[model samples]
Target: MTQLAIDVPENIFSTLRLPPAEFAREMRIAAAVQWYAEQRVSQEKAAEIAGQSRIEFIDELRRRRIPAIQLDLDELEAELNDG
Candidate 1:
């Protein structure tokens, strides 16, 4: 795995009231969420990037109200009509 180092302003942690490690963890999850939302990565990849299991990642998506399935209106209609 590749490691990245970044410089963050000192006041950020105090302002957010989060420890450095916790802040970094949240940033990773946020990045994964954005990439997944934009269709830039698969669910598996996003989960890996978020440092979470597939099920956990899916649960997080649900909690955030993001759709797990990416379907268009026509596809949704067809699925609904299938009995």
Candidate 2:
């Protein structure tokens, strides 16, 4: 596992009304959501990156009004056929 370090100015915390820890957590979730929304990563991987369970990540996606399903036409058809 690789660790990433971001240097944020202390004043930004005040502006966001969040503590450093909370802000870091929010950023992690945001990154996970963005990557997942873009289909750049799988939901499981995104959940791991966000430090959340699969269900929690899916809930978060719903909360953000982003579709949790990423299947395209071919994939959807295959899934429908298999079901």
Candidate 3:
């Protein structure tokens, strides 16, 4: 991956503190969380939007303390078998 360097004035940067790159990451995370909570988009779809893999998306959800598991009884059994 390639990275770009950005420059901002000290006062403006200090006021926000978060760098632009970090801010983008946080926004992506926040959007995923909100979409899950309110809009209830599927993990795969949300992950796609966030530019993450399914597992990574799930971990991101867990990091934010969201319950990332949603399975029916059949799905649970399937998961158990797969595990």
Candidate 4:
């Protein structure tokens, strides 16, 4: 595993009520979620990047109100028509 170090303002911890370690974890999850939402990565890859299991990642997506499936209107319509 690769480790990354970033500099954050000291007050950010107090402001967010999160310790450094927790902040780092949250940052990773947030980045993974954003990438997943943007369709830049698959759910499995995002989950790996977030250091979470697939089910946990799905729960995270639910918490963030992001759709787990990426189907658009056209896809939905096609599926409905096919059925």
Candidate 5:
């Protein structure tokens, strides 16, 4: 695993009420979620990046009100018409 170091303001930890380790974890999860939402990464890849299991990542998506399936209206319509 590659390790990354970021410089954050000291006060940010207190402001967010998160310690450095927890804050790093949250940052990872947030970045993974954003990438997943943007269609830049698959759910499996995003889960791996977030250090979460697939099921846990799906639950996180649900909690954040993000759709797990990335189907658009055209795809939905086509499926409906095919059925």
Candidate 6:
């Protein structure tokens, strides 16, 4: 378990329905996933950073319609060939 400090605007806080402590945890997970996406991190690694199991993270990615893999056409072709 980890602890963090956070503050939120009243309107946003109510809108998110976030309790103070849980808010920080959720925010950390959200930020971690976003940062990982911005940095182009691998799914497995991103899941770790988000503090969620890979299966859960992958499911969330699918639910969010975020691409699981960001591969160039050449890389995709090579991967397909290898497979």
Q: Pick the candidate with the highest lDDT.
A: 4
User: Residue-pair clashes per candidate, as listed?
Assistant: 0, 0, 0, 0, 0, 0
Q: Tell me, by TM-score, which candidate is best.
A: 5
Instruction: Give the per-residue Cα lDDT of candidate 5 at 46.
Output: 99
Candidate 6 lDDT trough over 10 residues, lowest sum: 1-10
User: How far out, in Å, is residue 60 in model 4?
Assistant: 0.4
Indicate the residue-level lDDT of 44 in model 5: 100
Error of 2 at 77 (Å): 1.8
**Which is the better candidate, 4 or 5, if ranked by lDDT?**
4
Q: List, residue by residue over 1-83, the lDDT tens digit for candidate 1.
A: 99999999999999999999999999999899889999899999999999999999999899888888777799999999995
Shift of residue 41 alpha carbon in model 2, Å? 0.8
lDDT per residue for candidate 2 within 1-83, as digits (tens), equals 88889898879999999998899999999999999999999999999999999999999999999899999999999999999
Q: On a 0 to 1 TM-score scale, where does candidate 3 land against the true structure?
A: 0.61
- The estimated TM-scores of all candidates read 0.84, 0.88, 0.61, 0.88, 0.89, 0.71
Give one digit per residue, the lDDT tens place, for model 6 in 1-83: 55555566867757888776667667756775676667567777878877789888877778767776678799999999999
RMSD of each: 2.2, 1.4, 6.4, 1.6, 1.5, 2.5
Error of 6 at 71 (Å): 1.5
lDDT of each: 0.93, 0.95, 0.78, 0.97, 0.96, 0.74
Q: After superposition, how far is residue 51 of candidate 5 from its true place, in Å?
A: 0.2
Worst 10 residues of 2 by lDDT: 1-10
Q: Say what the RMSD of model 6 is.
A: 2.5
